[model samples]
Target: MAYSSGGRLPFESASKLGHLNVIESEWVQSLLKDFETNDVDNADNYENDIWESFDPSSVQSLNHIWAADGSYVSVEENHKELAFVKTALMTVEQGKIAAIDKEYPHPLKLQEIMKDSALFHATVFPLRNLKSDKGNIYDTVRHVIYDSMRTDENGQYFETLKWLAYKKWDGQKNNSLSFECPHCSKVIETGIPYDQDTGICPHCHKEVLLTDMIGFHLDMNEENASDSVASHYMLIMEMLMLFTVIRLQWANKDTTLISDTLFIKDGPMTLNGQYSKLVPNIREFLNFAKNKERPIHIIGSEKSGSFFEYLSLSSRFVKPDPGIIKYAVLNHDYIRRVIQRAPDRGNPYGLRTNWGEKVFVYLDENTHMVLNMTTGGYDRSDAYPKSSDIIGLQRILATLPALVSRKYEGALYPIELVNGIASMSNYPSAKILQDFVRDAVH
Candidate 1:
């Protein structure tokens, strides 16, 4: 059962498991009662002091702050030193502080901060002893006062522990969406809000579903907390990709940035075993891209899951005939190549060699084919087919000008021919080949 911010009670009254029933009904109620009592006491104190010390001017500013968990260093003789450094940014209004935000380095670092002796626990005694010489004067306070107020120590440790526990609870929860569409030659951005669906593209107008989008709640727990963060990160990446795509469409009209741009998911792109929810969402975005004739590129980190398998499965849904879409399992070596080559030329999207030659087309390069997946993928794949199989497909497509022309068949004859060649060479299932051919002809 879950509660919203508005304080609505969950419909399910009883927990299915007997052990949880006691914890949920009895133990939780007791804890809530205790919390309420403490709140009442705090409220009384606040009310009592409402006028005596409530000078608005003395309270310098109210700021929002965020903290990253911490880092660890192993010193000589097998000694480990845990150092927790939190980054705080102040958003000030005129002269007052407005907001501060913090994020944990990684979920695991929270646990490390709690257990380590060198950081959190070491400052308690000194903090407790700190006091101002002139207690009532705020300006007279020294560094010790700031240190005591700024550092959490025990609270940080406990908060980290609580976050880890909440993460555990979140892991059991599931959420995601999915869709289907033809493969386009351009890069497509899916998961667009329905309100923003209409487009000026010559091929289609009003291309997205207004009501198809849904919000999902994820369970939080210790074991899968990291996984949850990774999933959220992927969602953010997808959003960023959409932003980049939109920027290309209306703002920049650049193809090279879209083509050469690489998005890195902190973990593998695989959706784990929870496919029913996640896959459909991914499919929906891909389908939208196909309709828009856009190529979508994604890469996952070393910690990525079965993303390759998922991509392989998703590839089947893409009509091979259009030859608009292709995906690859990019490992660390591939990512390293992109990073290394980014520095040499005046532009990042120039001629850079990875496993083979790769031309980084900027956002402006080849504007006509910038968002077209079939043409762009073919062009890029032709330049840098990561594997021999992809290279062979490109070679076959390159031969199509001799067999066909740009007359009645559309400018996509080359793409269709390439798909046919790929199907013939790869010998995929009959259903897949037939689908590919159908997509190509249509």
Candidate 2:
């Protein structure tokens, strides 16, 4: 029988088959074993000694809010070799979609079917190389993405990642975010680490492959390439979306119409892979936005995770203040107790990619409560730093609860709007992109 662990069950249970239930239990056990082997018990480390608590009394009024999200799918044809990847980027402002970007990268085999359609003009992606390699599509897609990152909406190229990396590396006292050698697993730094494009790891004295350090594995076969491509597209969308926000704020600083606007993203503020090394640059970008006429309240809210699961359990015990919103930073002890399992006896919280402090916001009694938050703050070197702006974080906490869905426990209204517009399906987004190209060309 499905019973409520916390006053009421968080979700309704679906009818379960006995065999499926057995399979699920076995899969969970396997996952627990894998977690123990990885030593995830000691994975979370908080830099601060004391987690600051805040009392949120009131929320600031905001005029505009912007949220962005992306979705993608891979469609393999009858032959299984030829595939098409359809990706969509949607941005919403004030509960309406402000922009949309859609792209379909298909194999040359699709050209015959899509005769002269405008959709296939530059959409015919090459899968083979001059030597007729089978998986050259990866390089072609990478090149297109790289070019897009450098180019603006007007098709003009500018220095972005490389320049930002060089600037940040030049200013940093030590390269804390340096790539580890694949051969030695030791961090290495070059004389001009950012300018070289690529380098050899000093520890191993071997060439460093960007693909290894970056989470996205570029050298994988076509079947696995879809994941890498999707991740790349999402990351690019995030970067561009942020760039647009900053640009708009910069241009409209003098006018009150754009000032005091809040930008919300669907996930954590931290970027992963080689892109993660640019955290310092992102901090600088935030600083640039803040220096304008009115402060830009940019923050991210996560809807799901093990962290949120634990937060839900921990919430049942706390009695919150109604007049004042309460919050605390997540320390090592709290995180370990809540998230760690058996066999993890060590005390290293191994969260390095995230630079912000993880905080818990207790918003009122039971309309819905507890936001797992990370705040952007002043930290030049360490990827995850202890020092965060409590006031700024409090501002975010205050503003967010007002935006939460009244009927849903963990969803924000802005994110829900963008998800409805950007989410993909096999029937609509993926199938439509594929069918249209084939139908138009034929």
Candidate 3:
């Protein structure tokens, strides 16, 4: 007897139809309702007054240049959580990997590093113990979740919170950092209450975590598990890299080496997550570098953004001759047009997320070369602010053409080098982690 297929033919098969409509045309039309487009010709409106013209020769020769990037991966997925999370930090100098830090199986390994390293200090507790209602020792866990959001791989490590608690951590001694109430934003004059997850905010009259008050936000969306972890890993690693650079800067204080070097990162100089409050600290670092006399230029250059995308499509921009570069000193008025926003808060008057002043640069008319640049030390406010020193902006603009990547269009070589070195390929990371664990067991 021939066995007949028991359920619904095992599976239903359908012929592949090319270019099938994934979204309803009506929905597409609805999305287009708020879609606004302006004539590309308008880009020329401020080209003359805003564009800073520079020749290729004006680019400065630097003694040293460095860039950094970080990567994270979930090694194994369990029923309700990732079985293992792996993270790696890479720093490159002059197209060479100068430093690297990685964590596997446990993030606490990172905390140990931070605790022992003279370059860093732990301002906040990596883990805390909570007492039950009866005032009995309840349980303890890692500080992996913040403001009800699950953090990514090895999130339990507390070194990530040091930036937020730096203002309170005493050097050489791991002391509790003073924090404001999350609800009130009021400074808790008496230090964080003992054995309590939350404290009463005097100003707002609400219960809030003292740690959350430090660069933590309830408005941040952390619903996507993978995305959330990746964000934390990136932020923590970026800050750590900055710390490394800062230590270098401090070590060479008596020498001119640090001053001659330029520190560049792949993305904006800004940090996100619970560590965002550290931005002011980064700004201070910039100022400190500048005050040392011969300042080393540090900047964050983006390869893509909505503004960059629009600038690419705009044909009205005046192109520079071969080996020359053209740059625009972006203002609020011009930015609003390029980045469309709701009538309420979309105006380009102030910085929403980015800490650097938005700059648009064309590497050359000879190629499809465009770059987005941001420098540190500028005050982040909502109002349209001009670079106090236009000459400084011009000097930075002049440095780009020399750093352009010969391999990729619209890419910077240093950033490309660092990114390539830092990025962890899926296969390599998996193999490395697996082999590492296997060796450990053996």
Which pairs in model 3 have colliding backbones? 152-229, 349-382, 350-382
Q: How do the predictions measure up, each by TM-score?
A: 0.22, 0.57, 0.57
Backbone clashes under 3 angstroms, per model: 47, 8, 3
* Model 3 score (lDDT): 0.44
> lDDT for every model?
0.24, 0.45, 0.44
Candidate 3 error regions (>4 Å): 1-49, 56-59, 74-78, 83-226, 272-275, 294-296, 341-352, 366-384, 387-395, 425-442
Which pairs clash (backbone N, Cα, C closer than 3 Å) in model 2? 42-348, 43-349, 43-350, 44-349, 45-349, 56-325, 114-441, 115-441
What is the per-residue lDDT of model 2 for residues 183-236, given as tens digits with 9 covering 90 to 100?
555655542254443466776667654333343333334333444545555654
In the order shown, the candidates' Cα RMSDs to the true structure are: 31.4, 13.1, 13.8
- lDDT per residue (tens digit) for residues 41-135 in model 3: 45553334456556748455454565555554443323322312232332223322222122121345433322311111111111113233432
Model 2 CA RMSD to the hidden true structure, in angstroms: 13.1
Model 3 Cα shift for residue 253 (angstroms): 4.7
Candidate with more favorable, higher lDDT: 1 or 2: 2
Model 2 residue 385 lDDT score: 38
Query: Taking the tens digit of each residue's C-alpha lDDT, what string does model 1 give over 1-442?
Result: 2322223222232234434555457667555444333232233322111011111222222121111111112122233221111111111121111111112123354223222111111111111122345541112122222333224332222222222212211233222122221112122234332223112222243342211121111222211112232233223223222322222321223433232322222222323332222333343343344345443333222211232222222332322323221223222333234334233333222112111122111111111010111111222331232333122223222222222212321122222222222223222211211221233311
Q: In model 2, which regions exceed 4 Å deviation?
A: 1-59, 79-135, 147-152, 155-226, 251-259, 273-275, 287-296, 340-351, 365-391, 424-442
